[model samples]
Structures are given as structure tokens and as C-alpha cells.
Target: MPEPAGAEDWMPRRLAARRAVITGAGAGIGRAIARRFAAEGARVLVADIDSGEAESVARELGPPALAHAVDVSREESVAAMIGRAVDEWQGLDVLVNNAGIGIAANTPDTGIEDWRRVLDVCLTGTFFGMKHAIPLLRAGGGGAIINMSSVAAIVGVADRAAYCAAKGGILALTRAAAVDHAGEGIRVNCIAPGTVDTPWIERITRGYDDPAAARAAMEARQPHGRLVSPEEIAAMAAYLASDEAASVIGAAMVVDGGMTAR
Candidate 1:
């Protein structure tokens, strides 16, 4: 893959000639990962359902970073996104399945539509990303796949029946994919994060009568009394994408400020 302009000096040789595809690249952890990967010399395809934000992020990263509107839940869309990556960057070396949604409906009150929507994006979407990305990675002699899971995957959380179920499925999916592909040189893993300070959390608290109280509740739940930053999660992601984490597979690295530890 060709190096983007102005990124020649700072790009790491380890990743300089590689290409990465990150879903949900419109904001938060996904955006951070795209920027970090581009800085390290990896050509990136920032895929998101929000085309505007995705394009903005890609432009900010300059050349070699392109934007594509992708609905990861759809097989055709995911295949197109992967095809674009291969066509643009020549080959793919990393896949970050970061697209997801969180629904707060309790199990009893959750509608079938809502349940399927959450599962479609968080679990099924991730599966599709892996399914489409595997062939590309194998064609390129193998690569890394990072799936974004959540602390809910490891623990039972209230008022998040669908979200938890989807996330839990992601944990199992990660392990299964890792075991099945390790011999083929593909490294599959998931990152389970606690409450990260992202727009998603902000939106979740917006309608609360006492937003402050709701925010406080979340903070109190974390042992550190604060939410994790997107950068912190991105640091771990960058490590996993690098050769440094060659042996890390089927692992769900947690970054929840000890929330699940309790």
C-alpha cells in the first residue's frame, strides 16, 4: 500500500505498508483507532453508517485513509467495504469490528425489533465483519481482527438485556473465530470496555430527569470513579494490531476500570 502524504516520517515500518479497515469510524473509539493506525503508516478505510462523519475522519487522516458508508449488519455492504479496501490499499492487514449499538430496554419490556437491532449490529455485524475480512486477510498472508465487545459481555448488567446478550455473543464469537483461524495465521480477539466517555454514553444520559445523578451512578460503578477514555482503549487496540501482540488471540482484553472485577 502507498503511504499517505506527510505521514512518511512518523509511520512505523512495522505497519507502514499495511492496510486496516475500522467499522464505526465516525466517532469515539473507532475514530481514535483510525487516526492512530494512519499515524503509524497503515492505510485505513474508515467505514460507518454515518457517511458525513466517516468522510470527515478520513479527510483528517489525509491520503491513504478513505471513507465508506457501511451497514455492517448487511452482508453485501460489508463485502463492498472489504472490496473497496483491497482495491484502494491493495490488500488488507487489519480489521477492527467496532460498529455497535446499545439498547437499554429490560428483557421483559424489550420488543423483538429492538432485540434484533442490537444483536444485528453488535453480534451479527461483528460476525459479518470477520466473515468478509477473513478471506482478505488470508489472501494477504494473514492479519489481525479486533472486535469491540463490552464489560456487559463479562457481567450481568441491569436494563441492558439486548445489549448484554449481543455483547456476550461477541465474546463467544471472538473465541470461536480465534480457535478456528489461529492455524491459518489469523489472530482474532475482542476488547471489552466499561463505560467509555463517548457520545453514546452522553446520549444515553440525555433524557434522564437527573442527568447528573445518572452520570454519578455510572461513575460510582467504576472502581476508579471515572469512565475510561477512548484513547486508553485505542492504546490497547494499537498494541493488538501490532506485531507486539503476535501471541494474543482469543483474548478479550478488558479495559473497564475494574468494573467487572467486582
Candidate 2:
């Protein structure tokens, strides 16, 4: 039997029934990804240290989107968060470790405590996310893990010693996990984004002596002369989680708008 004329063979949403857990989903890029995932019909668990903000984002997403508080640096919290997602959706399909912090200082100027804090939240936190999410993802069959790396991971930037270390570590873990889990039906990857137009960047620019000049300097870093949008990153997340990227594993997909072209 032939199909009806003009019948498009596709779904209205890309991620239907896909269970996803996105950390730092309260605001900035995390919030955008959560929103985008929910829009694509994924059952999302919005996890953040900020409980109120997490709830708000989940509420806005409607049913099947739940909110939870999680300190990603803590293994217990990460475990509980992942457990919640599994409990709600019956399993896990995608895990996006998007929570991170930055410390703006050179190696000589960065304090021990500052470096520890940055690594604890950015590097260790990602470790926790992957450690807990991988088992469930494997049990439910092959799934995707998207770590949020940065241009700092692949390039040297002034006044970003701690951030560079943590993000660079993420790149290492992403690749290692991809290798270790490829046989387990799990795919691990990462996104290395350039200067993005998020609240975090806005706060940095506003704190500078000349906001306009500071923002212009950031814009100049990327050849596109514009910051990447959170939604654009979300789109990448969608693709990585969907079957469309079945063969994309251990890839640090650069979403830097040619910032590292030089």
C-alpha cells in the first residue's frame, strides 16, 4: 500500500519521550537548553543549585518537566538527581553536564581556594554527572552525554588559568568516557563554545570599567563578531541526543563561530 500524498514522514517534535537531565538548568545556557529540550518533547529534569529557579523553569515547561536541586560537585547530589530522572521517566537517554563556574585570574594570581572551587564545580561536577548518569544510560541502552567545554579548553586565554584547567579537564574526560563506554552502547561528546551571550558574560562585561569596550573585545575574539546564542547551543544538544548523531562520539564539536580559526 502506498502512503497518502503529501504525508510527511516525521514527528512534530524531535525528542519525544527522550528522558534528559540537564544540570545548571536554572539560567543562562542551561535554562535555554532546558526550554529547548522541553519544547522538543523530552521529559527533562531541570537540576540546579538554585531550587527556586529550577522550579520556575520546570513550571514554565509544564508537565513531564520536573525540577530538582543539585550541587554537582557533590557525588551524592548528582546521584540523587539522576535517580530522580530515572524514577520519573523509567530510564535515561541523555545527560547534559552544563553546570560550570569561571575564575578570572592568571595562574600566578589565582589563589589555591579559587582554583579548587573552580575545578570542584566545573571539572569535578562534570565527573559526578558522568559517573552517575552512565550506568542508567547503559542499562537503558545506548545514550548520549554532552559535556560543556569552552574555547578555553583548546586555546590559551589571558586571565583564565583556573577556568582553562577545568574546561580542559572536561575535554579529557569526555574523550576518555567516549572510549571507555563506546562498547557499552553509550556515546560521550562535548561542545566547545566560544564567548556566548549569556547572563554570565553580561555580568562580566558590566563589571568592566568600560562595558562597551569590554563587550567589543569579546566580540572581536570570534570572527563572527557576535556572541553565540544559548538557543544555538540547545539546537546542537538536540542533534547530539537524537539518533541523527548516532556516529558522533568523543567529538568536541566546536560552536565558537570560528573563534579558533586563527
Candidate 3:
């Protein structure tokens, strides 16, 4: 039988009517996630430390998508970001704590300042985001929280002591939060991606004498022989945020292309 005129399409809109906030959404993985969520019918708040970048992404997504400047490491900033989302959307349904930074240094070589900076943004920032958003999620009757961890948390990465520590903390936090809030209808989960081919990777590569060789070497380390794409991670995030993943709390969905299989 033919479909009626103006009827809904057969496509999947897994996140229809969801109000979501994605931090560090101006570029890379966060940007991809924001785009995916919007395409899936969710209204997104594109939050990032770079106001211009955030606004650009929000503009690209058109109406119902907003941009906010936020330093997720600061509790006050994180609070304001969440408050704005609730105010604009009348409630919150999804929060993606995707903001993070790293320092390239071994434990002994890593300075206290570098260590604190990485932890403050990568780990504590996630804490701040969840801390403020959870209350609103409860008020709205339930929601999903997706924390962006990394393969470094599960496998050792040379010259990334602070990053590894921060990501490891996120996994632990996700598990505890999931357990504590599952009864309240809230689901918490995480994504541990391997080296993603983002601008961040380009920057790291440029620091090497042979940028091409360095990038190739990095890709060779992956079992798939290529860095993961931000869009791949975004797809996983969309699943975790949608009703399809209602039973996926506390899970660390690895998008590492079998990086840990060996």
C-alpha cells in the first residue's frame, strides 16, 4: 500500500523531541555528535570554550540549535550552560560531557600544572557537567548522560600520563553514576575511542619532524590500519542517547577498531 500524503517517512528518528547539550561541540567528535543528534530530530545546544566555533556550528544546524560558550572545568560555567539549555528547551533529556584536553608527557616529566590542567578539563569538567545536569534530568523524569572517555583508559599510551588518568577516572565515574541513577530512569554510559582522525591529531602530527610518517605510524598501531572517524563515535553516542539504548547503562562502548583485541 502507498503511504498517505505528508506522512512520516520510514527513516529512523531515534532522538526525536530530545533536548541535548553537547560540550566541545564546535569541532571533531563533539561536532559530529551534535550534527548527528540534530539530524535525528533532537534540538541541540552546541557548547564549547570557543564562542565563535560554537556559534558557527549552531548556525550550520539552523533553528532550534543554540550555541553557548562554556569552560566545563569551571563549575559556575557548567551550571550556567545547563541552566540555559533547560530554560530554552523547557527541560533536558541528554547531556554529552565531551570536552577534554591532554598533555604529552610521561608521569615524571609531566609538570603539576599540566597534570592539573588535563584533569581539571577532562575529568573534573565531566563531573561538573553531570553534577548540574543530573538534577534537571531528574526533574524532567529521566535522561541520558554520555561521557567521552578514550582507549587510553583501557590500554597504556606512552607520553600521556595525565590523559590516561583523566580518562580512567571518567570510566569509573560513569559506572558509579550509572549504578546510582539507574533506578531513577537515568542511564549513564561512556565511549572509549581509539585515536580519532580529528584536528587534534593533525596538531599532534605537526609537532613531529616527519608529520606524514608520524601519522602513518599512529595509524599502523590501530588494528584497522586507520584512525577512527569522529562520525563513528557520534553514531555510538546517538544510540546511547536514544531510547534504543535504554538497557545500556554503565557500559563502555569501545569504538577502537579492535585496538584492545590483541
Cα lDDT tens digits, model 3, 1-262, are 3321112454367887799999999999999999888888888999999999999999988877899999999999999999999789889999999999998999999999999999999999999999999999999899999999999999989999999999999999999999999999999999999989888999999999999999999898889999999988998999999999989999999998888877
| Per-candidate TM-score against the hidden true structure | 0.94, 0.94, 0.96
State the lDDT of candidate 2 residue by residue for 1-262, as single tens digits: 3322112345236777799999999998899888877777788899999999999998887777899999998999999999898788788999999999998999999999999999999999999999998988889888999999999999998999999999999999999999999999899999999988898999999999999999999898889888899988887888888888889999999998899987
- lDDT over C-alpha atoms for residue 13 of model 2: 65
Q: In terms of TM-score, how similar is model 1 to the real structure? A: 0.94
TM-score of decoy 3:
0.96
Backbone clash pairs for candidate 2 read none
Model 2 stretches with alpha carbons more than 4 Å out: 1-12
lDDT of 3 at 199: 85
Number of clashes in every candidate structure? 0, 0, 0
Which should have the higher lDDT, number 1 or number 3?
3
What residue runs in model 1 are displaced by over 4 Å at the alpha carbon? 1-14
Q: What 10-residue stretch in candidate 2 is worst by lDDT?
A: 2-11
